[model samples]
Target: MTDMASAHLSHDPKWTRAHSIFSAPSEGADVALIGIPAHEVSLSATSAHQTPGAIRDALARYSTYSSAHDVDLRDFSLCDLGDVDSPDHESGEKKVATAVANVRANHKLLIALGGDNSITYSVAAGMWPDLSKIGLITLDAHHDLRDGVSNGSPVWRLIQAGLSGKNIVQIGISDFANSREYSQRAKDAGIHVVTRDVLRKRPMADVMAEALDIAGAGGREIYVDLDVDVCDRAVVPACPASVPGGISADELRQAAFLAGADARVRAIDITEIDATLDTPDQRTVRLAALLVLEGACGVASRKN
Candidate 1:
């Protein structure tokens, strides 16, 4: 009780390295982080648009050192490209596409923080001129093969836009999150589906190895779509559709690390988190921030 308030110290720049302070894209860097804070067509709430800013603030709490990957994030180059202005769905997708093209041209790796899962279509479409040369993997609870233009339909949209279903591999599809018709659509398109039940039976590393093999076949560049809804509800309170009994927080972070470690993984999208809906502690936003750094660790491990 001896003047505790007077003993408080400010956040030191040397000790607090926030993600927002990452260098600009014009300066050139190994990874380009773009924020697509557009949720015009999200199935859940509209405030997902606040995720990018919240995550940047949350990133200030964590150190850059990654003990698991044995990589210091301070050594890696990351350009924070800032957020895109997409007031509507069409404009959002178009803006994201243009930004992604610029990021792909300048950065070795592209990591997009999403307003929703719909950004996946824009990111993947923008990254590769020809879909045949690309492989897509989604770690999501839903198949996302719905009919309309919303968070629930990026996969269908990507397929319609020339992405070959054979090159897409979906993991962690939980029960009650998908429908029989979408399942048939995946099968019809030859999209590989690895159920959560199946995932539980095997180690994530093993499952990821097989997924990467399918998605990276014929030396294709991979784009990973990480929908936070694939995580357990407790970990991602901001993800409206996330259910119980899903992948653990550590497992999702490990997935991001593994995806980044592969040179074939050209880009990744971390989606479906609405900062406004997050708990008072901002756990969801913090996790998303860590995932971005974990992706950087993956890039560090990749061969030039």
Candidate 2:
């Protein structure tokens, strides 16, 4: 990972724009962004820990293509705190918790670049210390309300950790093949399920506002977790349990826009990028990179 990260222009004269916001708190700089490369996990996206490096590479090209980020990552205060080196999956929960705790402690909004959905559990565990009430806004094709580990089933574990089901506002549940029991568990627990049908019917803007209201119910620590599979397979690819009719990039971006606009949202994660399913040239990392930029810009705009 170090080798790949070194290959990128994390620090280059022309890329000074990206570095302007990439300041470090260790340097006494108030960094608004903390890129956590959490790659050790049980799901496909967890492998994305290694992908942020690729995203950096892609960002260099993208920023050069557009004069926007070249103007100092859009003039945002950010930093790449680097990845959490966790090798074992069984111990992943602990490692991610530590990494996220550090990010939270730094007072930087965590842009958790993932390896899988499992990392969300660790991120939540870490942020639990500072968060009094938390709301989960999960944008996925499937409702990950399982009770145990079954491929990409970290959301269930997150709920088990006491993240109130009622506080969760699940959007773009384009598919829910789990079971009636699973649906009842989340519903019984008070989790709000905003189906794609409903989302399409209602104003996306109002839906976000309502989601925020639900998420804000506890106290406020909005965790946005996105599994690439949640997106239309056309935009991405197949995952553990694949599905059709996923959310579009624009929809996800709009959601990111909402999350970023909502000051209560403290942490965000864009997970599940299968480079194997990328372009013919293997450039799938752009999706994640663009997602991060959208998330960052959203936060930057909201904070302003």
Candidate 3:
């Protein structure tokens, strides 16, 4: 075998590129991953704070190339900015916005690994100084319209922060995972609700096309948030609120890729998984890693 093929040897630790394989953070790269490793301030719990690092570890076990997309991750330029440090949720919000603002300023794609869904408001606030010019799309099991500063209320928080409800589109909303009051609030706010049942009734590509069209309306930049809880409980063992029936793992990856490939999508985030609660096989973390890769693949394809 040639050196290149031989180098694929199973025992070759040198060829193993962990998640850290990406180039180090720089002002030059057009795509970057930023970690927010604290959920205490957002969820009122600290369990998911370790997820960012765990995702990187799981990523090391996989190849960077995607035969399906015909794209090799190493061919793309991306940076890992490590993690943001904040003592409280209030500060965490500011920190996240600042990080996202930095990415926007550099004209780069921001892939944020979140402490929880709360990161959405902060990211949107940072990416669009004018909320009126922004569109929000969330693939989540819940409306996230709760009336508090916790993980369940980011959508409501963003609306209060000046985001137009008409520009928000929520997908993968599952049964029994939300309250009637919150559902009514979503409707009253004019938020477009695309339930898990709706997805079941249509092709994923068609649903995503419609989602992108709605989210990109008026030429506004889109911020897509992927709450891991949107996936089935079997696929997201680490997401405490995840239910039994939801989108499949492959479907979620496709959604992320579609969002990332859209020119209007300036930022994306994956949230709500608690690494400490993950299965022994680390299936959840591995899936999260693949989601990141799929997003990167979309970015790479766009550049090509």
> Taking the tens digit of each residue's C-alpha lDDT, what string does model 3 give over 190-210?
999999999999877788889
Off by over 4 Å in 3: 1-20, 42-46
The sequence of per-residue lDDT tens digits that candidate 2 reaches over residues 1-304 is: 2355346445555554342345444532233444445544454443455565666555543452223323224455566666667623657556666655665556546777666666666677677863336888887766777656633566777777677777888887764655788777778878898877786677767888898888887567688886666667666652434356766767776777577657778778776664444665443466666666666666656545
Q: Which stretches of model 2 miss by more than 4 angstroms? A: 1-49, 64-74, 87-90, 130-132, 238-242, 281-284
TM-score of each: 0.93, 0.81, 0.92
Worst 10 residues of 3 by lDDT: 1-10
* Per-structure clash totals for the candidates: 0, 7, 0
> 145-168, model 1: which lDDT tens digit per residue?
998899899999989988889999
Best by TM-score: 1
TM-score: model 2 vs. ground truth = 0.81
Ordered from best to worst TM-score, the candidate numbers read 1, 3, 2
Query: Which candidate number maximizes lDDT?
Result: 1
228 Cα displacement, candidate 2 (Å): 2.3
lDDT for model 3 comes to: 0.82
Q: Which portions of model 1 show Cα errors greater than 4 Å?
A: 1-21
TM-score: the better of candidates 1 and 2: 1
lDDT of each: 0.84, 0.63, 0.82
